[model samples]
Target: MRLLFVFGFFVTYGAVLTATVNNPWPNFSGVIILWFMIYLITAPARRRREYWENRRALQEEYWRSSIRYQNRYRY
Candidate 1:
């Protein structure tokens, strides 16, 4: 999903850039660069989100296994 979004972003940016070749008033590079900078800045937060999600999944799996172990030992 993230890959798709990144790909879409570059594709859109390229398309807009190509479309603006005739006009020289509004420069899109700055806007695109700004957005790319924002994306780079927010990368850490995205990684943290992914980390937390993975940790939560692992914790859930551990609890499930613990519960099964306890149940198996209960005679």
Candidate 2:
């Protein structure tokens, strides 16, 4: 999926660049809009990935602390 996004971006960028070679203003604006659109499209996926990473870290910390507490109380 990520690879697809990257590939698509490069392909679209190349096409847009070629198509707008004679028009500098449109070329610049098109590239900017393309980047913004890609960012918006990927925002949800990025958020979800961050959320899972944070959750995993919290779970690992909880387990580590619990194990340490148990060991300290053991006779």
Candidate 3:
């Protein structure tokens, strides 16, 4: 996480420097646009990962309870 923050800092700063050197506002926003695009692209994958994680956890709990119930009723 710390490394990610440092990398992000350098990337944004580097973009700013590049834009300033070129003096183009439209292209300057390209860095922000690129990041937004990346986020949009990954959103689905991220949600899918979370969905499966939750499903697995719920299934585990369900089976645990089922086993406990069966044991309680055993002769």
> Candidate 2: what lDDT?
0.74
Worst window of 10 by summed lDDT in candidate 1? 18-27
What are the models' TM-scores? Answer: 0.47, 0.60, 0.52
Candidate 1 local lDDT, 1-75, one digit each (tens):
986797567756664664566785545675577567767987999899999999999998898779676698677
Which regions of candidate 1 fall more than 4 Å away from where they truly are?
1-32, 68-75
lDDT of 2 by residue, 40-74 (tens): 88799989999999999999889877967669768
Q: Count the backbone clashes (under 3 Å) in each candidate.
A: 0, 0, 0
The TM-score of predicted model 1 comes to: 0.47
Q: Give lDDT tens digits, candidate 3, residues 1-75.
A: 974785587557657655754565435466676666667777999899999999999998898779676697677
- Scored against the true structure, residue 1 in model 3 reaches a CA lDDT of 92
CA lDDT scores, all candidates in order: 0.74, 0.74, 0.72
TM-score for model 2? 0.60
What order do candidates take by lDDT, descending? 1, 2, 3
